[model samples]
Target: MQPPLIERNVADVCRTVLDDATEDVLAVGPSPTVVDGLVAMLADRENGPSVRLLATESVLKASVSEFTDASVIADLVADESLSLRTSAERLDGPLLVTDERVVSLVTTDERTAGLATDDAAFVDAAREEYTDRWADAESFRLRTPPLSRVQESLEREFDEELAADFERMRIALAEADGHLDEVDISLLAAARNEALLYDISTWGEGVGIASRATFSRKKTRLEEGGLIETEKVPIDVGRPRLRLLLGDDHLRGIDADEVVSVAAELLAAARQ
Candidate 1:
């Protein structure tokens, strides 16, 4: 018996398959773009089934580029909205099996097309094989700390005022997506509260977000661009620490929500 062919635009095919699943979907042999697909699923809050992404070690390594930016996947994992696992044996292309009933295996050309099968025997066999494989697969863990940990650590390591400012900046720019990186957000949040460079950078590194050198580099860029300024705070310790402050007076008094847009305008003006 021939499985019926299903075709959809490559861009939309995966999402549609995900939406159609009941309760849970096992996605095997995912490509790097799986990050983007997972992000989209996370953004949409509904009764859609939670996803389990199973891939090889090599494929997971390649996906680091996709997960480098703001990690929504971390949040999803924390809330049990998603799961990550790795397979020892090589797996085939993107195969989505939902609730051991419907199986959709997507293939890409100019458009995405795949064979779909609901035959009782085939689906049952697939369910049993994948279940065994999943049980044998090692769980994959993300290096970056969960967003909840990041939130709590910020408030504990720093003052609530600074933490609140940081949270505000994060929520304000949640939809900004790629416009700003974590370094920029951290710097901006720090500037709002005149936070210590060492404190923020240390927190960032401790949470596995970035290193001190990366923070320093971004700090220099912001300072040279006139978006931020820092004053030295003399202490009993070895070296004086720099306290971050918003360089632009206009930025100083504006609401925390305006930081992203105003900073973008300033950066563009500086570049030109």
Candidate 2:
């Protein structure tokens, strides 16, 4: 068999081969442009060949926003005729193999170049390679609308922020020679809530601190160490309840209002 035909116009060759495909089409790459063309070709056919796309996370994400008709892609995915997946590792470029006869290799980066041929052996090799990669690749699910993507990104950022804050608190407490027990950590976490003041007994029990006497002892120690403070607030005809709040020293120069504003923003973004 002659060597595969090398062509610079990758998109055109992909279109021609895809149009001729009678059985199935397998595509592996991170190129949104080529993927877009494949999607368009599949959409135009009345009862087109089965299609499978193996792409990188970045490529999938970009397609959701960049594609002219993402709804059509979603429809294809819903019907099971079109399958999408993401590779665990990056793919070098785009490879398109159709009906186990024609193969196309397209450049993924700046320069547009490709190779296409009806060479059986070359097509077999490409198909086998795609099969191996597809087996290891994770299924790709596209997020709807731009907001869903934004919300996902914000949620990840919020999780990272919370982890960083926990690590910082751990280090700060360790360096200050203030080894916070479980009770202390619980109290601190509760204090970071919107309602800074919490009922000590209720909070302690919720955190599994069980005994009232033990909780009171821990509370007293925290107060003496300048980590927390308490005030008595009277209830209707009942004994005044002690409310716990973070002490001034424990505020770490963070304003309560500012913290609330930041938290609100994070919550809003996550809800979006």
Candidate 3:
């Protein structure tokens, strides 16, 4: 019913929301920084209220970091008693925030879904929406420790695979000084895009809408096939630093087009 302790300051907004008496809160947006703050607040034993967040798959992937104990949030949603829920949009941008007293629904136009309803109706609607979402959402919560272990193993495997591909590409290019066709270079770049850097998409649906297993598998396959390289970068931000990935270095100081032409010339001569 009141303005969401509103502020442009993301941390302050989260602190105010978390400290409030409101037992339930819904945030709709694609900002991972805000979501991470909210999750941190909720994860707090003293200040955080039970929180429900809804947004699109792309937003979640972009925002949620892999380091947080996402399983806790997942467990709360799965419990059914806490009445917390999260939703993901197939598209992008804007988010929705609702509590017992207020709902801030963000939209593509940078406006939130503004709806006026009684507290009772809001709760009922949120609950109904959450229930429907839960049914459709692929499980992002993993309680099975073994599964977590398996996921860790898969991640390592992907990392190794990506490294191998990088090495192979480097060797192939070095043998002929990286003279390759523009088309071939473009193809490799496209493939390189699949590498799962330290960003949130690797966390899968728990952070947004894409299926966790699906994102994980796709990223893993890219890594294992040696098409990418993953590493860790340290930062002093909210969460600890994370592992990241980068595209293969095609060649040092060589223009993309020049490399392609040189490679094509070699190939044509060989054919003759």
Candidate 4:
């Protein structure tokens, strides 16, 4: 007999399987929505099943492309709320197998659904196959560092005043930042104090946020957009370090929390 197929909105497809699960959950090659969905679900509930998510590089890339969401993933992993891994091998799935049942996903433009079954043979086979695959997978790491780590680094390495400024921007930008990334925000924060690009970029790299090249490229882009200004600072080293500053009269001397909003506004106006 054919297993019952329950259709749902794409976001809800994973919830059904996750909610009904009594023990561990294993997912292989999940979709971006599924990955985000599981992450989001874990955010609201105190706890759910112990989830083991294994993804392909392509899907994992798509999932953590958003920095905010990726930050949460990092926190979840750090706390052991979610066990995430990725495989280099060819495994295509949005397949989910739980202690009580097995679920196979069906995705479409409008909705995603799951065909769930409790059959012993099907569930056991899926569980075994995916368990083996999970064993073969490696821990998935994202470029976005956990929020806690960022805070700790800022507070410990820099003074409280600077760290507070950074936290203010982070909180302000959490909801929306005109599409600015962590690099953009960090550069802006650094420019607020006319801090050196070398210092800021080095800090970012040490924090697992990004690389020096990435910061340099973003600084160039921001400079070209007239969002920030840089002046060469004399250093007793290989090259003169560049100091970051806000280029716009409107952005200069504004509150730390307001920088992202002003920058975003500037970007939107320029787009017009």
Whichever of 1 and 2 has more lDDT, that candidate is 1
**lDDT-based ranking:** 4, 1, 2, 3
Candidate that scores best on TM-score: 4
Q: lDDT tens digits, residues 1-272, model 1? A: 23544545433655666666676777777776655555565656655678777888777666553323235567778778778889989787677776645544554544555456777788778767777788899998777666677788888998787777777777766656455666788889998888999988998999878899999999999998899999999999689999999998778888887887788778878989
What shift in Å separates residue 159 of candidate 3 from its native position after superposition?
28
TM-score of 4: 0.73
Off by over 4 Å in 1: 1-24, 29-50, 55-70, 78-81, 85-95, 103-118, 129-143, 172-174, 177-179
**Residue pair clashes in candidate 2:** none
Please report the candidate that would top lDDT against the real structure: 4
lDDT of 2 by residue, 22-101 (tens): 87788877477777766766666667677788888888877765222454577677666688999868685677677556
lDDT (tens digit, per residue) of candidate 3 on 67-186: 223434443445431232235535222233334444342323222233333477765776566545645654333332222332444345355543344334433443443334212332
Better model by TM-score: candidate 2 vs candidate 3: 2
- For candidate 2, the per-residue lDDT at 168 reads 44
Superposition error at 91 for model 2 (Å) = 1.4
Give the least accurate 10-residue stretch of model 1, judged by summed lDDT.
Answer: 63-72
